[model samples]
Target: MSTSSPEHAIDRMEDRLARLPLRERKKLRTRRAIQDHALRLFAAQGYDETTVEQIAAAAEISPSTFFRYFPTKEDVVITDEYDPIMAEAIREQPAELPPIDALRAMLREILPQLFETDLDALKTRLRITAEVPALRGRTFEGMRATFTVLSEAFAERTGRAPDDPDVEAFSWAVLGVLQAALYRLLDGKTTYEDLPAQIDHNLRFLAQGCPL
Candidate 1:
């Protein structure tokens, strides 16, 4: 059984914040507060019915402050803190490891911490993203941004340009596997406890040249 808990996640986040400068830590705290309140409002009132003003009020911030952190309601739903963390973790992997192997290792280390952070909020975010038309349309934009982060990390490790065809292909392929896993979870075909393993399996398949 999973040993993850919300309290542990909060502790982990606090530990991370303890390392940052005061201003940056405050900014991150506010950002997390806004997102947390937004997700709660979205889940309770429905995404279309939950106004930015309401979310801002719930978060104890002004609507302008909301815009400062998230440009739009859609951004509030789709954006996350994971991409930068993933980029850094990928870069920190052993230089001798291949891109796919490095990704697998990074994900193995990161996914459990992520799942522990706030699985319920994560599920609500994914559900809203899947159900809302505006958010669904914006999913590709999010995917593009993630792809760029992944491609740049891979390029830096391999000494190639971010836009190189091989880098782009490998990055997009990883995204595809991740998207498939998310869809399965959203469809109730798999539990969150199994998601990391599923992702790892697909990455292994990709590493094996996707044999039939």
Candidate 2:
């Protein structure tokens, strides 16, 4: 699974989000494609060094088209599709499944897809994300968004506010585990394959609740 695959999952959701109106969906898809292209440029040349015009040219879109999708170069950095897809996944889970269990099930559906893609590109994305402060912040912000989306889904399903302490705690805990695992990977402390298991164990620890 390449890193780009999960991000591509975000692109597909952008396609679906655009569908309330046919024209709007088309716009959303184009914007997402532009963002993807821009990220590629940012990854290739340093984010600060890569100009919007360059990204637009690479994507075969107008510079104005780039501005249309992302107001600033930084905005384009914030486009991760995982939240919407994860929300959709949680929504699809059977009502009877406990919230944590539902999340675990949903992750199973999501993570395999990540690992299934071309590994090299994903590694490149990870490498870029790790090295760039702006990209790293944007990536974490995206993860925070993902956690919020999950918390909202759980709250809706379980009749609790998304911001309920437990929900917030669970959301952050999952995110924290993923961050830790990614850190391990980038730090040369663990293999990519070790991530899911490490994250799973951390989440399990959180789910079981910390003993006082």
Candidate 3:
């Protein structure tokens, strides 16, 4: 797979979550709608001008319910549910598998959920994230958080500190492949159908050997 970063991976996973049962899909869609509404207002009025109450009102969600879903106004844009699921998926992977291979497998395993989400919404989210500075930072922060999760998994597998450079670098490369594909998709240069193989081929080129 093309090397990918955590943001791109999360983006992909969020895409898959769209494939859940109608109830689940509806929940996620509503969540996405709230986020879209929040972002639209934030963009139109400026971050400082926006408030959770405004977002809640715009989303047609109760203020209390908005708090139930997100911690703060800024969180509506960044704190998506898919991040934890990705980490759990990684952790659930057989420990014997190399971390990079585990990530690839995890991506495959998670594909069903990806197919559940709306591609159009994903593209919109990507576009908004690209244009917004706060969103860009939060996206990278989300990536960094995933790196932390991956580091722990790698260390657990290899008996090294999670922060060890080799562990981190290896994790980084796996994410790099996904990011490459995402950049292409976000730019209208590639379609989701073409991404997996494109990412896999690029990843094979990078892996050289060692089984991934």
Q: Which structure among the candidates has the greatest lDDT?
A: 1
- Residue 23 error for model 2, in Å? 7.1
Error of 2 at 54 (Å): 0.6
Model 1: per-residue lDDT, tens digit, 11-112? Answer: 765665576567866776777789999999988889999999999999888999999999999999898866766777788899999999999998887788
On TM-score, the candidate that comes out on top is 1
For model 2, where is the 10-residue window of minimal lDDT? 12-21
Candidate ranking (TM-score, best to worst): 1, 2, 3
TM-score of each: 0.88, 0.75, 0.64
Lowest summed lDDT window (length 10), candidate 1: 12-21
The global C-alpha lDDT for each of the candidates, from Candidate 1 onward, is: 0.86, 0.72, 0.69
lDDT of 2 at 153: 93
177: Cα error in model 2, Å: 2.0
Better of 1 and 2 by TM-score: 1
Per-residue lDDT of model 2, residues 1-212, tens digit only: 23556677656444446544667556656876776777677767777799988998989988897887777776676554456656777788999998878877777766656565424446756777777787777776667667778789989888999989987887787778668778888899888787767666666766787444
> Candidate 3's residue-wise lDDT over 71-115, tens digit each?
666567655546545666777788888766776677676654454
Candidate 1 residue pairs in backbone clash: none
Models sorted by lDDT, best on top? 1, 2, 3
